[model samples]
Target: MDYLQSLRMFVKVAELGSFTGAADQLRVSSAVATRSVASLEERLDARLLQRTTRSVTLTEAGRLFLDRVRTIVDDIDDVEGGLLAATGVPSGTLRIAVQGSIGARYLAKLLSAYTERYPLVVPQVIFSDGPISLVEGRFDAALTNDTYPHPGSVVARAFAHLEMMLVASPRFVPGIHGSAPLTDVDPLVLLSHDDGTAGVEPDPVRRWLDTNAAHATHIRANNSDMLRGMAIEGMGVALVPAVLVEDDLDDGSLVQVMPETPLPSMGLSVTYGSRRNLAPNVRALVDLLIEQSKSDQLPVALRHEDAALVAGD
Candidate 1:
């Protein structure tokens, strides 16, 4: 048995806390990963992990070994990266996961620009709105919102700031003057993100409704696109990222209702697993994104009437 390979597998299992997850990340079968870890435990003459049908947990000895093994593995990766960098040619399949909403417009443009700059690099993008596990997914990076300052074995860099707007269908609010008081909007129905409000503390939207429009009916949907569709159907009002609804607003299907009340902006960030020496290709992509973010080209634009309303308020 290759002890080095076993060590690597053990480290992955420790980090992800699932044998199946480690197997998937390493691109190996579950049986192979199980055998590798078992072989390591036998060599050490100690039980490293306690496994249940549902989860994997590290024993005390396993925890201590994991801390040391992570350092060793990281050092080896850095050395390999240094040697690869010496070749001065960047080439790799960069696997990335992006927020589903942003993937359509902004991310598509950024990716097009990236590929043009680095023709040697091929990108595989997964679009979803769920939490991304960089190591478990074996991805080079993730472009997402919601998980800011990501925890252990991960790093996050802000890529874009997305402003949000409160909007409603023209028929629902009818000639809704921009300066109209929010209190006066009658028969309010709020379409919101499905944040599982059964037990947990209410999210910002629910809390806002509770405080400002407690009488308004609330409907929950997971996707922002769905919320936009619901609003356009004249079902209710929705507070959504401005960029996602810009075309709709321009076409007069959706109208901004409360310009004076600025919904907090959502931040987009690129995240990757923590590594001492990131590959040159990955680093280049991260740098390009950061530079683009610094230029601030993706500013949110509200309609002219809405802008005036904010100014007047």
Candidate 2:
């Protein structure tokens, strides 16, 4: 058995705390990963992990071994990465965590473009709306909304500036064309991930609700496409990414409401931990994102009717 390969697998299992998760990340089967770790343990004469149906954790000896092995593994990777960086041919599987499905459509396009440019690179994206630690989740990098609070440990760079706007069907909010106070809008659709009721940067919908002095929302969803769809169906007024509803506005199916009150543009960032040496594959991705972010063009526009498709994603 390759000792270095076993060490690499052990490190992943420790980081993710799941044999299955580590195996999936390494692109190997559970049995292969389990056997690799077991082989490592046998060589060391130390049990490195305590595995149960509920969780996988490091034993006392495992913890000590992990601390040393993690550093050794990182050093080896850095040496190999230095060569790859010099060659500029990023060849590896990049594990990425996406904040939510809100940007799924555009993210897919962006990754597609990235892969095309660097055929040697493979990106494995994990879609999650809730917060997941970059370290605990064992991610190479993360694409996140700007509002997501990061510890001082990570490096977050500009990814894209997504213009946001409030839109409604003329049938639902008759006062959309007129200068009516926000109170006239009966229902307000909200994006759940952006909720910051008590925090510094509140969700756009939360800001609107506070402005109108309302207590509740008509609809609250994590996906922007879903909110856009609600607005199109005349459910209520929704603040959504301009790119998602570009065609709707063009066709007049959805008209911009409250044009005077602008919604905050959702800023996206590519974040990675600062402690680790930037991997060549991760660096390549960040470089591409920065290049594309020059003109708010991270993703292509999608029709509002495609909301269901994006929601299911």
Candidate 3:
């Protein structure tokens, strides 16, 4: 049997869940497609599919084999695409993940621009408030904050730094002013991503909680947008990316809590598998992001680091 061709036929059959459908797509006869998959299973000595008159399904072994086979196929395609880089246009589904509201606020625009440039590449976006795994085969690339753990098998390139600041509505905590010292403004309610259990390395907010917000009520939510909304409604004080609340600050809806103290800026990185050569779609997306990340019009983009960015730990 032509092993690679069999694998391709099986992959298409598994994806479409119909032998006739797979055969039509592969431009082969249904008998040829069925024979290829049967030959594959015979060689492997494992039943890869459960065939019924109505539909087809993958067995347990088939499911596991499918994942690895997909990788092998994709890697082959990536190498071929790279070889034809000069002539071929990048095409395929590009799956990307972003950390949270901050990513949605800023990185979404960059992705929108990327789609415009690479129309052939379909983009799938995942927005998460917690850790994202690149090796798990879920995401092709991700936008992650430096605070979160990055897998060693991936390469992380920090491009932008978000200057975080403590903020709240003036009506929430009336007496706090810009000139007031950090010691004087004791927050009644602390709105944060961590409920003091996350054990994230000490940042400005964590240090502040050590003194001022020590005895305060902890209002924890995984979503930064939710925390920002809470702060806007005068529910509590929150540490947020300054860029996200610019309009609120200007409109007197939200005020900066601590003006004198410097808050640690969170670094943003693009994480991908540590391949020798990136997939065509992945490389295009990353290069476009690096280009789009350095505009003087946006304060966060202006704060972007040089090309010599910090990599994964």
Off by over 4 Å in 1: 1-88, 146-152, 175-184, 195-215, 299-313
Candidate 3 has an lDDT of: 0.73
In model 2, where do residues sit more than 4 Å from their true spots? 1-84, 175-209, 212-217, 295-313
Which residue pairs in candidate 3 collide?
none
Best-fitting candidate, scored by lDDT: 3
Order candidates by lDDT, high to low.
Answer: 3, 1, 2
**For this target, which candidate reaches the highest TM-score against the unseen true structure?**
3
What is candidate 2's lDDT per residue for 234-288, written digit by digit as tens?
8777767777787898998898877776455666667876323467788788767
lDDT of 2 at 149: 66
Candidate 2 yields a Cα-based lDDT of 0.70
Show the colliding residue pairs in model 2: none
Question: Tens-digit lDDT track for model 1 on 1-313?
Answer: 8887798789888877888877875678999999999999999999999999988999999999998887787667657766665565567799987655653567777788889988999999987665556666778888765333233345566566666678899898764446555566666677866532245445445556567666657787767889999999998888777878888988999998868863555556677664435777787777677667656444444111110000000
* Backbone clashes, each candidate: 0, 0, 0
- Candidate 3 lDDT over 225-278, as tens digits, reads 888999998898787778788778889999887677665676777877633346
Using TM-score, rank the candidates from best to worst.
Answer: 3, 1, 2
